[model samples]
Target chain A: MYRLSGGAILWQHHPGLPAATFLAMPAEPAPAARPVAAARRRRLRADRARQLADLLRHQILAGGVPGGVLPLEDVIAADYRASRNTVRQALDLLRGERIVERQPGVGTVVVCEKYPHGLDRLQGLAETLREHGRVTNEVRTVGPVSAPGPVAHRLGLPEHADVLCVERLRRLDGLPLSLDLSYLPMDIGGELLGCDLENTDVFRLLEQLTGGPLGHAEITLEAVNADAHSAAVLQAPRGAAVLMLERLTRLPDGRPVDLEFIRFRGDRITMSGVLHRSL
Target chain B: MYRLSGGAILWQHHPGLPAATFLAMPAEPAPAARPVAAARRRRLRADRARQLADLLRHQILAGGVPGGVLPLEDVIAADYRASRNTVRQALDLLRGERIVERQPGVGTVVVCEKYPHGLDRLQGLAETLREHGRVTNEVRTVGPVSAPGPVAHRLGLPEHADVLCVERLRRLDGLPLSLDLSYLPMDIGGELLGCDLENTDVFRLLEQLTGGPLGHAEITLEAVNADAHSAAVLQAPRGAAVLMLERLTRLPDGRPVDLEFIRFRGDRITMSGVLHRSL
Candidate 1:
């Protein structure tokens, strides 16, 4: 339990200590003890703010915050029985994490949103997020080009082989979601040039063209700073972090057909899955 | 083919164009065509730099760059038939991505590393990266605490129930790697108080204490900005993005045992997995 009164704090229980321990502090120090006392006060305020921030963060992540809008500073301070400065510091901390933003007239609002993406299923964005909204693709560019060394190697082609490069800007609910850059071997890609890429996903197109179900995919996921072009396309701030998914998909016959580099807005998507103990 | 000569460029092939379309340019325009021609020249240089950056990025990711050190600016310019200014711009782009950095005495060097973490296996840090380096844990805090609301719900306990909280700073090769905060039910955690937590993994200890093999875990992964405390503990730059992994582990009998929130330095870890096409 924590109690704050007259600008002084009493921490009854701390995680670092065992059960049943109390530490009491002086209520008000003398005025002559100014500099050292002020420093101690600042440190104590920081500690209290951190504790408040942790509790609020856990609540926000668990969707327990009512209405997704934080109460005013005075209300928070009164509820937590802390000073206004402490509440402000806690909000600042959450703001730095981008978990909350202070709107001009709307008070502090939760800005964190993470749509679930399953890692155990090799599904297209549209198929996986069917319940979310309509996923539309704006095919920015699509044509044949000479494959670079790494692309050719991944697709099991010789150096400088022709491959179709498809660049699309994907959106959900009219908001930018991902920028997908896909490379396909010319044999299958040549046929896709005439398909309706603006309406359908490449996974469905490949299956329709090959007349067989896609088998599996090998994927690597990481967070990388978005480059200028990707940032502009995804509507993210320059140098902001983006979730980069590099996937190589193979056909049922075990031929690698499509290699994709997808950059998703980090704040909008969360990848999830279940893992068993294999060992 | 892309050819540059006398400050004029000839782009014969482009990904957005058909198979073999030639784009020939006037080698040298008159001096009076200065303003418009200069703007076009700048745009052309920017395009060339982007193309070069893509090729170099692919090479670096594939580990095909000899010695992991880039060639000199002049050498790259000459080899690609691009101007020195274009090479410098491309290097600047790479530097912005943090893929390559310039040292005081050394030339540009690759700085990207993604240690593989398998999503298909339920393993500890030490078990996952046995070949990379020895993983050591600095047990910063370990004791009993009243469980927060969300944690109690996850563990099937009443709110504010007594639970064990363990905070650790993990390292790889003596470099700060991850900061993990774990919560366990008091039944199992009481025994952990007397164990050697600094030298062993909690997963191994739980199995030994329970006399049963662990079952599975549900995980959610996303990129989050590092808070002040996590940044200081993990030795990462303040507000830099880190990979936040929230995991809930269950016993073979379907009882949720441990819940953890692990923050891994985004640049130091990569999560990889193979997924089947499950409908």
Candidate 2:
């Protein structure tokens, strides 16, 4: 029995092939078939550079370059014994995929990747940071304020009720990257006011306060440009492109619990999204 | 009663409030929620560009750039009174969400986005081209032959079936940008040889010959460097990046139909994939 690649190709044997071969013994090479593993050893350096690129990409994704700093040219080319051009090509491939990006004057930066935002995930900002192998936070702004129209609309709050507006800047390896703004009802957040923002994440704080963890979440992806304020904090240029993610989380009983705004640098991210349908 | 953007925020309400206030309030003097749209000047500019960008993007997706050339920059910037930078930002936004690009030396080239090569939406190669805009095909080879493993699996034919393989180069506005190799069952496609490839899409021919049309398809996206032979035909450099799409098309009733191989210039085309809940 002939076997083919899963979900891609099928292989089936013909019972009448021998009989057919006897009748059609005189034919030229068939068209459109990929040549079976031919040998003509003029070139192809075993593609060691390509393999190294693969290794590096996997490492980056697996948090090998945990600090998000990657050497640009020297180490990779040296390790693979490939020309800088070849190494650069591999890096270019990654850059095209937005897996890594050059920071102009600085070295290449690894903008960590996250699971494609979805309802199935209700991870906290701290959990996402820890998953990427780095963590730091600075609460830029937090205060009790009268609910705004939109926020009040989402929270189903009386226009006069105060909501806690917590603006936290998240960092990786001491460098600020994302500006996360969260809104929590005063009822749920009243006890957490004295906590240090630089050292804590809201999700963990909420679980500690409520005695239960968060569950499903709904998130949306949008494209945005950084204004001067965001660019200065994120260390990117003003008007630098960004991917904006807005997420609202719910507990197991469908109670809305958290609302988060995640603004990711556009340069160094490669997010994977998958769709599987039920038959 | 209130409305939040269609995600998890719809249900949650601010405690102690029945409805949002200031729904009819005049624009506030200060920025409140969503810093991105906080400023009147910036928000107006951003919104105009976004709407215009969406308009142009639809045109591009509809294959309105048939000459494979258009003054994307001038038309956008002048018409919108947006700076070249702003217009470029809009283009880049579309570039990421859509598959189209501009090379330094080459004018803006329109690369028709290809359908996925997955098992669900196995569109015939020519039909995929037609969706891009007006197209013409020039057949290079058409005959029965052995099928590649990927093709074999997709067709669901016996591994040893004498597959009908058709190879053709396709063009838009006289510029050859893509080449295709399609495989079908030999008995089912003997009629394909009689049709004129230069004039019509092969799927239309298949519908006439086989009494049905393809329904759903699934596609996989990958990158491949064009070989010397492929580079010569596509007029692109060997080792230059090319977008490769491998697909399997199935009949409306779920029987396997056709498998396709498509190679496109990486710079000219971008790809769009969606991840959603399974139905």
Candidate 3:
């Protein structure tokens, strides 16, 4: 049987098995107790690593680490007053949860928790991202085009009906994230032709044009291979798997207002939320 | 300009452009109406394709097609009373929506929508799938083991505590869909040691064992690359992206009971639900 004693708790265990005895130690161990002391040191290191991981998780969730990049390992170790091995262990914990990824030469980077959109809320991407922090839009195209057959049907318009197409590359903290393509009926979208779309959200613009609150949306999420257009715009490799959100937003009275196709890089975004059972 | 005439409508427009004019026609035209007749036939074919697609979509959503595979194109054509080409077009529509994928030599298959679990419901996968139809479970393992450090912490048990580990491969319509690993405190899970797991849902068994309602769960969703163990069991390629749901379930009085890690094949499943904006 092996006996381990630190400052407070004394534990006795069979070698290579779990501890079966517990007792209190009154004083520090003698220097002859080298193996048990080493074990205690390892356990203390593990505790320290867990503590550091908890701190970093909170900081990351609170947006303290902007741009989703963590500091160098040595820097983190120095800051936490822990050994390099302890810091490595802590980062490994985050990596398992996908909260961070270690680049070969770039150090550990905090990569989890992309702007979360509540699947239950009828909100636009821009509005959702804005609530998190600063977001910018690069409007690629805004013009009238003949609606595609399927799009026309979804928008309750006749085949080949006029529609306004607005394509934007959305950026969060200056990092390219999602590509948003929205189609709007001509009668409602025509008014926004002269307006600056780069500074305005299409959902908000549609709300203003229709003079009513945008109601619920029928949203479908799918894993799709990025086509040429989406791959180039989202900067993902050709045919890479991406999360596609197809949304048809309607007015409060059930009049369809916009048909949007949004593509997000799967590696860079995670959509998550809590579900409460309704009584 | 090209002039096209159909029953009750006449239009003149560029041959390959959207129609610019529409007018009513009184009677059947002479042999000169052949071109317009062909165009009308094409339009009708397109309409028929869309209608077929809608019907198939509804049928698939209602779980009418078991094993997540659609019928052969000719079979679907015969069933819908549409031409083979029209049936192909309908399948193409489903492909664009990521609802079905065409296997190399196996024909088009309904690939997506594997028992959608609403983020709003506090339901287990087996429970949700059972509500729709039959579900079977293959219990891979059930035994007492030392809890891994992270799992022990998540379940609020001491490090190296004895816990019951259960691994199950869940099947829907006889096709393996998900691999689930659950760690439960021995004091709570010990009662289930002798129970038949294949025919019983774990959540239901837990409720019975604990004699209390399983309370809210802290759930997290992430896209993760499948590891070798998971890839082999789930029959997905190594490094294939999959949806991972990590849940820590609690009892009504806030006692953590189970820590679960569930992996779902991304292409075969989609988690989607409506969100309402709270005023």
Candidate 4:
């Protein structure tokens, strides 16, 4: 984890080498998170380092630094009390997380988030948000339509079966977020179709209908453009950065049941996954 | 689909649909796609519906419009020689597969091809690009270091285990495209650490070492800012757009083996995925 300070290069050696480990330095007691002004009196160097990393990490997350601009060694060393080598080490740590990268001539830059999906996991979009904090979900449209194409193929729509399309706007802390449309088997979700979406989670709503999802969900990720309707609800420019997530769900009996399309604000979010290597 | 030719739109109605359901104009052969000017004439108007779709789809696939921006109604209508409503319908078809969305004030923008993950189907960074056309991988750094919390956690690495960190500069058609690093528990990947990296697919290499991957992966999505290194390697500004992908892999028997972080040029790629609803 990078300090929101200036990313001042936490110089602790990789722990547990037996002899070279920096000796813990007593954890510094987190220094009671002194205010910005206290540095002149106590622990000057440590305070300097902490503040530096904190400031830099905040800038990186806040979009203040723009994207891909690498802070120079001279700039960082001058801004903070640490040496150039210390700053270099911190930059390398960020590189380890794929948060930044070094280019032969371009120096270093911040890596933007990749808009992707965790298809193999059972986590839903909102669920993913709640983990970090409370993001917002705005329900815009909910209606029935004839399931078509792969969606039809996945839901087994009888070529003419009516499907419920739940359109909503997803946000992080009230910002313009993802806009998407979800389709449900009319015969199943038709009754719950009229339920209030504003105050409830769709998964919970689905549970009320099917007694609870069997638990396995298959997901796919893609890149697409924003259309007029989604554009209006997401409040993003018609063709801004938008990430699309599609998923298929099944009952315990292994029968596929629903289809959903989730669009995310490309500038604000990214995705990661775990892969299990075969023996 | 939205075409860049004077902001042209493409209309595609299922041939099997009833006459009234057609909701489109008669098919007219596309003018620009004529064999001689196939690439340049791609901007023409009077094209067959299928040809229009192909042209539009080609533009989307070839990264024609910046970030894949698609003009909502007017542009699409103009391209397909169809009504605004018909074009919207075609856009809807693409939305199902996460090909596009509508924004509140922005109209419609194309999603670049950067986000692609979250399904049983998984491939390495190298493999995905190869499918796009021609690409090359350049090894920049490949060495070992103590695992960090995230990578350590994902790879199930012990607190002190030495993990091999492999960093590379990926080029597509000779242009520097992305920067990536993969972490592997030394015990698991020690054998191949010294072999060819630029020309070898990690997955294939792993398979040759121990066995084939059992094919299981879990993904998470988040957003971050690009740093100095990222800016330099991606050849973007100090803080340009980027996409970071994190992944972990294990053996068939469930042994953690590989963890990777990939950073892509924000404006250079697009992403997409599919989803199923809850039963």
Candidate 5:
């Protein structure tokens, strides 16, 4: 099974195998294949198409279909007990969402793909996705400045206390992924002024500077419209929604130290985690 | 501290106190308060304003300012050691993002508000947000039917196995919040047919019927443009982004049983959690 970072676990079809080899037998008893009256049938067909699209979406997300390739049209109609017209409409709806597309000879295929980002781990972007591709950081700004009110408070510093601010535009395989604004206490940040900010993860730098493993992070995730500056920096369309992640990382001794605001392109990243019930 | 579910912890100001009373003394040694020569100074001043805006944004998210109220313009200038003009420009930047607004006699106050939704719990909407307000489920569709491909796989059922599907439009207070689609294997969902789905959480019913607490859930979250159907049902703007949460829940014995696709009005809800690092 192939699990898309977006929480879709699609059935992965083996290369060289015909797509039809993986088709599952129809579960529901077949509905009458005959078409009904034109006017009423059109209305019912629209509704059925929607329902079929919804089902196909779940199937696609589940990875029940092979290797992102959808089964043949006749196969889907028979499996869902829907007429060919209804199946076509369903496929059309998926097309409108840009989730799937028709290829000249490849038939219907899933088009939307996202990289998985683990929320449960407190690793830097590069560390988490090291296997996927090379992650490069383009350092935009790095210098000492007084902590803003909120930044100071989270880092447990006095208001206006001097802190090191680092701004970076991170890319994955040459594609813009996120714009990260990070603040660190000057005392710790000062020692790393000469270190490689472009190639190394800050999490790794902090551990070396502090001489211990970081403890935990308090995270809040939300969707927000990208401002003009952020959109321009990330190359995302102006006003497009971006996933905003605000995190405060603390040392094992429980002192809050590093705070970061990372804005990720919503289309390219998916945050996934296994969460346990606390209460 | 007021923690916006989206992970902002703002300093709450007491009622009746003047906003300026909470201002902190300047942190940096006043950046040579003397204004520099024109052309260079104008460019410098613009940069300063952007910097100031960034700081204030952090402070607001961290809850440093009082009660979502900005300090008086002059007071802000004094605190950040900036000229009044730069402070005003910074405010204008925030206003552009619609995060804060000017109220004639009230000064600038935060305009964005979101309820907190915890990511580290296996509770229904009502259970998770019981303290905030009422959460009512508008049952849109419910019945037994053949499980879709993905639903069946997630539920450990055979292809097209009979299952129950429950669709609900959940609201907080009277505002539309989320549209939820839930799938359960027939044995468990069948028992919930006559239960009070509107007022009671499915988690509660599942616990009662299964005779145990749920184990955990695997969740994936991302932002997606709301389709026409979802946009209309949630009363959200057409094509506006929504937070999409997909979850697969299991029993204590690790049996996958319930699968859900929940789309939240991104503007109204925030998902927050504390994550531990586990390599």
Candidate 6:
């Protein structure tokens, strides 16, 4: 009986024969052991593939494989003393995890890391940009006014009640990236009207003014075509794609305190989050 | 001093005055209590808005409000004995949750529920469609061949190893929805070549064949423009937007069992998920 172990076929009668000798033999095993032997061979091949995948995975992650491309199958097969098929299997594993992708004409290449948007906590665009570099705010308006219908409802205020509305353009490294419009209930945010909002983080200012940490928020993300106003503000062409994030932040007491409508240039932003089955 | 409560301004000295009567009076509270009284009033209004939002939420969920459009602001205010601003606030809350959306010239309308793609488990496209209605599969091909470089690597097989590839078009209510291409290791899937895949669920077939459940899957979702072949299979125009879901399912023994590349017509699908901070 010939047994397959880790991509190598071992002859029970000639156990020391190398893989080349086994391949040279007739490609047939005893009929009685065919089922069991075939199953074992499949498992062995799978194991070898997994081992190779792990080695390549480390190489890719460690930057050992610069340019994100693996060598030709024939080269890898010769180096590992394995068939081209085995090398292909290892490459497929990486593709499954999206560590690399294969382009028809260009061959397999590493995929750059995507931006991750942690959905666990409420994070604002200004904070996201500041993490990469310094962020500057261009305050367009900040004043107390009779809140609009939707704004009033969001802040738990009476329709048309007095509220503080702040409109600003956020820039990273002096380039405009997003347009933000925020509304705060005047009862708690009236003092914000007196602060230099352009220099202060709105979230921090809110925390200081409210004298407490902000709690959970409900956020909605959607894609929309850029309207004329948003296009001009984001410096994108009219009708260009944009990502809109609408957020309603609440106090620990479950009182909705602020509503924000923000538009990001889609080409410059990608939101990613890991979805879990259980919490 | 006068106090505002539930959208009604009440006079402490003239408690018997009707809400309409108080509205007709000069809009002024005692100067000594103005700041403190105003804060209290704001909180009270916020509470009212929250209460209204909760009520409307229940109504929306219960399908009490048909046609997805809520009653006009004036109507809700009069029915609830609240101001229009209070009603607006309630409406805005629903909007923030994406339960409703306001359309220009169309009034406030309920938004259609988005499809939630739970990243918690490995679910096949057929199962997802069956939940909505009957799903039918059209098998395009089922054969064995030398696995492509990427496919071989993913399956942990030798380069150009023998493998079984299945191509199918999935339909819902007789309308094409998505195109699915799956690659499986021939050692395990070779027998599948003889099965009628049009009537069988591939995942279930795999589980039965392997005598175990699929452990987990690493899935990636991205937007892509439909290519000629995919567009023709999905019955969508070339260059139309499509959602690509690539999944690599593994066996409980930590071996990758299958690789699926699925493309859904963008207009027919919207993937959504609630991201929590911790699991």
Clashing pairs counted in every model: 0, 30, 2, 117, 12, 23
Ranking by TM-score: 1, 5, 3, 4, 6, 2
Weakest lDDT window of 10 consecutive positions for candidate 5 chain B? B21-30
Q: What is the TM-score of chain A in candidate 5?
A: 0.72
Tens-place lDDT digits, model 1, residues B12-80: 234575433421111222235345556665554555565567557657776677888998999876554
True contacts kept of 1: 0.42
lDDT by residue (tens digit), candidate 3, A78-171: 5544568778888876776567999888778877665665554777667767776666677654555555455677799986676666667777
Candidate 2 on B1-279: residue-level lDDT in tens? 222221111123334653233211112112344444335445334433443454455456446666766576876565433467667766765554434577788766665443322222234434545655656676654555554333455577664456665556777656666776666776666567656666677767767776765565555334444544555667765544455554455566766656666766544444432222222
What TM-score does each of the candidates earn? 0.80, 0.41, 0.63, 0.52, 0.78, 0.51
Candidate 3 error regions (>4 Å)? A1-113, A144-153, A156-161, A225-229, A238-241, B1-115, B131-133, B141-164, B210-213, B252-255
lDDT tens digits, residues A139-193, model 6? Answer: 6545454554555666788766665556667777666767776777866666765
Best by TM-score: 1
TM-score of chain B of each: 0.76, 0.55, 0.62, 0.58, 0.73, 0.60
Give the C-alpha miss distance for residue A259 in model 4, angstroms. 3.0
Docking class of predicted structure 4 = incorrect
In candidate 5, stretches whose alpha carbon ends up further than 4 angstroms from where it belongs are A1-98, A101-109, B1-98, B101-107
Candidate 2 CAPRI category: incorrect
Q: Report the lDDT of model 3 for residue A258.
A: 84
Instruction: Summarize candidate 4's per-residue lDDT along A183-211 as a digit string, tens digits.
Output: 67766656654565654667767767788
Q: What is the C-alpha RMSD of each candidate to the true structure, in Å?
A: 7.3, 13.6, 11.9, 14.3, 10.2, 14.4
Q: Is candidate 4 or candidate 5 better by DockQ?
A: 5
Tens-digit lDDT track of model 5 for B202-256:
9889998988788989998877666566677789876566788888888888898
TM-score of 6: 0.51
DockQ comparisons of all candidates to the true complex: 0.30, 0.05, 0.13, 0.12, 0.24, 0.06
